[model samples]
Target: MTDIDHELEVKAVAALSDGPFKCGTVAIVGRPNVGKSTLLNHILGMKLAITSRKAQTTRHRLLGIHTTDDTQYLFVDTPGFQQKHLNALNKGLNKTVTQVLTEVDVVLFVIEPMKLGDADRKVLQLLSDKTPTILVVNKLDLMGDKGNILPLIQDFDLEFPFSEIVPVSAKKSLNLDELLKSIRTYLPEQEAIYSEDELTDKNERFLAAELVREKIFRLLGDEIPYSVAVEVEKFEVVGKLRRIFCAIIVDKDSQKPMLIGKNGEKLKQISTEARQDMEKLFGGKVYLETWVKVKGGWADDARALKSLGY
Candidate 1:
């Protein structure tokens, strides 16, 4: 991995014989738009979690594994605990957030620096008392006065009994080594559950769909993103190239034309961008096809949500 920290590589490599191999799952969670996915992607040195500027862009919990010579970290990037819309989709996403809380060895309670409000508090309340948690104060690079970080930490410390508090900037890769070291300290000594080379638990098909959804979130306006979901219809590989067909699911028929755009240009851009991302992630060529389909009120329908693997 190009983004691998040299210091971490040295420490991990040096510990191969003297140290016990460490491994465990970490839940990276926070309120909507708090940079949880960005942090996870940086930790893994790859973009396993799709990120967007929009709130609630991440709608699922995906595992990203980072293996070193002496430690293996399995990180779960969960959807932000949604609160505004109490629809089936939001409920399902919230369920996903709460469910993973009980399953991790440690929790990284991510928050934007100097901006812990009601949403952040609600998410923090869900952190189990039994699980060791680290208050990850992210976006440190954005702050003008770096010296004030300690006092900010002290302020947050009074709010919860955190095992540790780390300030980092996931965007600039600032203090990431410190964050990784903090994570290593909490992981238990055990054998690696996954192969050393494995990156994530999600299959290619699942990730392909997410890639499309990510493009929709990245390229489209605010209103259409929440109303969209992606489904990979067919994934066929012949020799070295992948031939993939996908369906873009929308909550209403009116959104379809907008998504497709005049002369199908918008749809083509989405497909091309998503396919390029898939190729990079998969390390192979991809032939992609996309079409938008109206699935009316799927966000509020439990049955439809379940079928779509919500």
Candidate 2:
């Protein structure tokens, strides 16, 4: 076996020990766009979540594993909490954050450094059971005055007695190592949750779909990306080549033209970029096909969301 593989075997053996050192789930919870997904990606040293300035980009609880010589952390990246309308998608999205409470050893409550609103207060009230919540103040890099964040911590410190308050810049990778060290301190003794080589619970099809959705989020503005869903209909891996067929589902028929653009130029660009990234991900040649379809208010339909594996 290779040196790295041998190390994994040793760690796997060490994990079988009776006492001390373990693996557990650390759920990242926060309001929309607080960099919860970004922070998880940073901790795992890979882009496992689709991140953007847009709200509700993460609709599911994604598990990213970080295994070390002594500990393994299964970081759960949850959907951002937001206002839910009558729409089923919104309701499902709202439930995603709330559902995370039941299945975690530690809850990393991410809040922006700028302000703590009523939503933050509500989260504090909901997590009143003292579930080992860590109040994480993210986006420190965006603040002009670093010292300004300290006061917010002091102010809210009385409102909610958090297990630990950590200030970090998820985008800039600031204080992430310290965060990991802190997380490891809380986990209980257990065997590794997954194989050491496994980085995420999401399959290749899911990642492939996410790549397209992320590209749309990056390129398209307004409500276009939010009302969008990418599904990989076909994925064939033949030796060094990968063939992928994906569909972009939109709520309105009018949105199709915007995604396709004039003479399919826009769609081509999106595919080219996504395919290049996919090739890098798989380390092989990729043949990608993209098609846009209108699902007629599919975003509001619970059945649609369920079918999409949400």
Candidate 3:
């Protein structure tokens, strides 16, 4: 090849290699049971956050990182914004939602299709007009006619001047690629904050605790799950094996029998299911031990909440 042609080829290669990379935090905010955690799990292709049918199942702000070829999407799944029953616990959760909104580069305001209620509107008011917010209409599978979404999209547009509106069914994994593409346009050009292999910022102990809590939310009665909290007191690793000890904290002594059940069957089921999930997530044998403890008013007490890692 001629010297001039060789020099041109080298410049072209350098330009392609040094293309701009986009990386920034994206907050997923919505009311309870609108499928925020499900979207995060589907987008990352792993269960980084716990989910259930019950409201207020997600309490913490979890950072789920997704890295593409040239972009690193750090998705923060915040707790559902609570309007009623504002106790100390729910107040803390609401604060988490608002705090996440202010910090993120893009906000995905997820809602159910054709059902924007007072609760959804309350959460919408928390969003900033300045931020590049996307109206993510989740649960499209629930809609009988797909054509109905256009009017719903128009209704949401009146509520906020969204940068983009993408309809998707997170549970069905529909139109997620389009949602990702829409979000990519708003992300700032920067280097990745976390490695590509890293899926979440939470440690194994925190994930272990969340898995146990998920079992409680799924298996137990509605009231019991709301009043319960799981804590991983001890987590020891021994060469592809995890030995975990967890304490299930209840608000009152009367609630203990409901959790332990006759012949300890209820607690046993919770432990078994939690162990199975931990094994799947950690890719190791998990020896889990659980016990019920009564900690009265722990949910409402700020000191107790702080101690419990709330």
Candidate 4:
């Protein structure tokens, strides 16, 4: 071979070896109670997004960042697209999901194992074919038979031409590496968007409020959890300590007693648990103070919802 040919071959091999880095936004979307937040927290390896057993627990667009040696994943965990309850709060949440779908580089359409219904289909309608999407069949731990997954994957393939389909158990942290590898394939070659150590875009105050709200959703009965909203009235940071004051808003005066319990024991339990979580997440001691107040139909009121940061 000529010297010129060998030089050209060496350059080509060098170009292929130095592959461009990948960094882009990925949106995680699905119906309520489909373990979207759980998936995000697992990917992040921390509790950045709040979780609960109740539906509609996530009401905002949360950004969780996971950076590896070769790629950085900017995951936007969106609220579950609401179909039934068209209240002011839910409408806002649905808007968040649609807005995120358009802006993301890749879309992770999360759903439960073998249970795709009208609500899941509704979310699928929002996805654009232009954007690379992956069907993440979460909760594989709950599935009894592993053989059923193959047919389930085929069934989902008929609905949309997904770039790739990955079944993951977010709760058990199974097949996450495979899921990340599939996601990295579609990420555009670019520089990192966030710092390597940064975990999320949300501030500590927002996380504190979410922790308190999560406890409420987990501890309380179904009726009261939806009506409640938490606001950090004051967040004072002094060196290694953080002092937080939160207001727990209720829709009616009758509901206040239920949250407060017989002698404020219920609220105390909620505060203690929330504070403990805050310490672990924040890496500092947190003194959390909470109180209940009546908001009188804030969930339906547009003005109230706006004030509450919905």
lDDT per residue for candidate 1 within 1-310, as digits (tens), equals 4334544554555477568888899999999988999998998888889999887788888999998877788999999898888888998899999999999999999999886799899998998769989988888888889888878888888888899998899999999988888989989987677766789988999999999988888898575758688888899999989999999999877899889998999999999999999999989999999998988998898888888889
Please give, for residues 1-310, the per-residue lDDT of candidate 2 as tens digits.
Answer: 5777656775766767545657899989877888899999888777778887777778777889888866789988988777644368877776777778877899899998867888777666656455788888888788888878778888877877788888899989999988887887788887665767789988888888888888887777674757889888899998888899999999888889989989999899889989988887777899999999889888777788888988
Model 4 alpha-carbon drift over 4 Å, by segment? 1-18, 223-225
Runs with alpha carbons beyond 4 Å of true place in candidate 2? 1-19, 84-86, 223-225
Cα lDDT of candidate 4 equals 0.89
By lDDT, is 1 or 2 better? 1
Which is better, 2 or 4, measured by TM-score?
4
TM-score, one value per model: 0.93, 0.91, 0.93, 0.93
lDDT per model vs. reference: 0.88, 0.82, 0.89, 0.89
Candidate 4's TM-score: 0.93
Q: Report the Cα lDDT for candidate 2.
A: 0.82
- Which should have the higher TM-score, number 2 or number 3? 3
Cα error, candidate 3, residue 176 (Å):
0.6
Clash pairs for candidate 1: none
